[model samples]
Target chain A: MTTESVRVAVAQTVPEFGAVDRNRRRTLEIVRKNADADLVVLPELATTGYVFESESELADLAEPRDGETASAWAEAAAETGTWIVGGVAERAGASYYNSALVVSPDGLEGVYRKVHPWNEEKRWFAAGSDLPVFETPFGRLGVQICNDQWFPEATITQARAGADLIAVPTNWVPNPDGDGRPGDWTAGVHQAVAHADANRVWIACADRAGTERGTAFEGQSVVVAPDGVPAAGPAPADGEHVLAVDCDLARARDKSLTPRDDALADRRPEVYDLG
Target chain B: MTTESVRVAVAQTVPEFGAVDRNRRRTLEIVRKNADADLVVLPELATTGYVFESESELADLAEPRDGETASAWAEAAAETGTWIVGGVAERAGASYYNSALVVSPDGLEGVYRKVHPWNEEKRWFAAGSDLPVFETPFGRLGVQICNDQWFPEATITQARAGADLIAVPTNWVPNPDGDGRPGDWTAGVHQAVAHADANRVWIACADRAGTERGTAFEGQSVVVAPDGVPAAGPAPADGEHVLAVDCDLARARDKSLTPRDDALADRRPEVYDLG
Candidate 1:
């Protein structure tokens, strides 16, 4: 099988908390400059802020799936003709979901609800039920929200579902007690790399920055290969940044090696109850 | 307050393929001879050997929770008056569990089934439904089997459950391709160290060795401190070995610097439904 290489970009920026218009504008500016890429990703909850203190706060921040934020993202995708995946809050009737939306030149391709809600998020959003993978211009792409990266099963399931490239949009918080060191919040990145290596898939993780409600955002967006070898940014300090890399989707698929031979193929789901 | 240091012996040995009787005999001999240690640990699947062919093979090797294996282990514990934790095939009804039995001078204290089975194990064993932490003469200890160590949740849960020390019994296979090269696998050791640092607990991981059914076991048995520093062996070779270290439980409990807090406390489990 032949492989194809596509140029991918990760937009790393610091979005003001709850300042949707400002964040959206800043994101578009970055996306516009990186139009040469096939795919681009942004941070989790980039449309809204990370801290949702009350039900009123969450409800106020929530927007429809086809709301203004997604429409703006779709417009950028159409203009750039590049696939985009990023964090957004979705409003469906009386409920709200922490979700990542994927957009292409054609339109809003799909939306993946963040399956794992971290800490305060549990009080705000309901859990997502399905795992979705989409076929993109570059290859098969999978989307996972911020905290979802911590679970091996999330990434593993995506890989098994035939995603050559997995993209994560995260609002990763830097370890405040890490003696103010820049590279201290690397555990998440390392976990992403291990997931890529274990599944033989390329992973692109884009994170937002700036301190939101005293929690400092770590913006070390990174891209890793099928061998779990890091290929791009642990990007420089906050502000607006773009990390571009040539991702070989075909090569990832061709070099696909499940560490353990077809472990998923032999799963006896009936006998075991995960709940 | 004066802190006391206890002699902990981590038995990092390589068991012969499918040699349950021999391995048990060696374990008993080691326990009888090593009178200095307050606690001892053996590798995962130390009894039946790792990489068994079929469910029937695992079943054949499986012993009742209170059967021969437990009796022998309990005898060693009673004779040495040392707390022992080791892996064995646990048979209950028609189901088989790759379990770790914690045997002390008093008797069999607790059992933990391997939570996340790797590779071929999915075919022979069922995933554990519950996580259990037990109290021992030495300290409050948490037990996990093999791949469970890879996930932060397993260790974090134990810490939350008030475990002072975490013991992992693993039959870890070295990367066949990683002959002399060093990279992520070495850095991956930080995962355990991070756990120790974050939770202020001592972590002792004993892994098996030797090529069994074409799988090469990498015997990197290690003991890490509450500071996330190495206290003992990432042993040099894949052979019969013993790594001894002095673990101060009180010191771990006293450390003020921790990796858990609001920003760090950010974990979203509701979104991780795929697993």
Candidate 2:
């Protein structure tokens, strides 16, 4: 394994609902704060926050892929010489999509829409079909938004497509009993770790913190290693933080669990009834 | 969602390497002790033990699906009126397969050969081609062994085939660094939880305890609910313990995470590149 490592950062910020401009500026500020990182990931809906009351409000907040938020993030990425993946509310013709934009130092490299929308998201955003693996200077990067993390297929697709790391931009809500322990590797974190371990790929989740319109967000932004260990923070349950960790792409590329077992190659697809 | 629940028990007993007779007796004893449980699960290769030395040794220890061990288990199940799921090394004619038998009061209901054998198991056991979901009075039961848990498709296939609970008879070897935490929800446990949460199906992992031939096994046998919480478990890392939990098949049946999201229905199979 080569000693090729990259400093990845997850910016756990509190985004106010419907405040697209403010949220965009706040995301840029978070990026600027962690300027030294090779890659920085922001929470889902970083440009417009989550929990909308009306379709009109959602339509008002949603922007195109090349909107002000992406433009500012692209500018910030150019300035810091770091790649960024952050979620946004996208306006495409008559439909809207919950999407994450991959911005490199050059510009907006790619866009990945949320494949599996959660709860109220169904009413607002159209589900995405493509799981893209974007080529980067450090490694091959993949992106998924919030609820998409719940589906193993999303990560499996990207990992098989040759992604060294998958960036998750999430706005994790508390469990029904309000027992979403962000401090511990609870449900959300466990899913991330399992995905990383099963796929033999690194996963970095950047989750938002704070209550927005009666709904509270669980902010345990973490960077998980291929061995299913959290390399970075579980941050705080309800506080904004920048969790950064040095990730070696070589470790992810080497999928061998043992001399005889390679995680991806070992999969018996012929026997698998995936449908 | 029906109000049907089953008491499931995971027997975390240490099986000595190559001690086929003793292992078989120990498994029967564990089952007899947990006779009150509607369903009981035992560790992988509970009859033959793991970490085989030679082909001849494996052949000598391996029995047919209807061999002595299965017969004993069937007798025990008939006596106790408890359904049982336990791993074994099966000798089908000249071929050896790593398999688990589903024994009811009637007899050996079904046999599931481990589809994904771990490490050196490849040399001795031929991987199976099918993922079976067996029918029981309490619920639909599915079986997978140890390393098969590493593949989500194993559980996904069984769940898709209409399994209420997936029984994982595991011989969890410690990580290379000897850091497989049995108390905490580490890699293996996280996988169980994630599988339960993702599929909205119950997962009972019966992992073995103690060292066998210088290779240590992590116990921490667990019963995970559909919401991804450990319903019972994470038994002592190196101790022989029977961890039991009441599992409501109705909870698994109700796949709805929210008012809008149903786990199984939400799966975007059309978009998944699961090749």
For DockQ, the strongest prediction is 2
| Clash count of each predicted structure | 7, 0
Which candidate's lDDT is highest?
Answer: 2
TM-score of each: 0.69, 0.97
User: Which candidate achieves the best TM-score against the true structure?
Assistant: 2
**Residues B182-261, model 2: lDDT tens digits:** 24554678789889888988999999988878887888898888888788877778778998788899887777888999
**Model 1 residue A252 lDDT score:** 66
**Candidate models: Cα lDDT each:** 0.74, 0.86
| Candidate 2, lDDT over the whole model | 0.86
Worst 10 residues of 2 chain B by lDDT: B177-186
Chain A TM per prediction: 0.89, 0.96
TM-score of 2: 0.97
| TM-score result, candidate 1 | 0.69
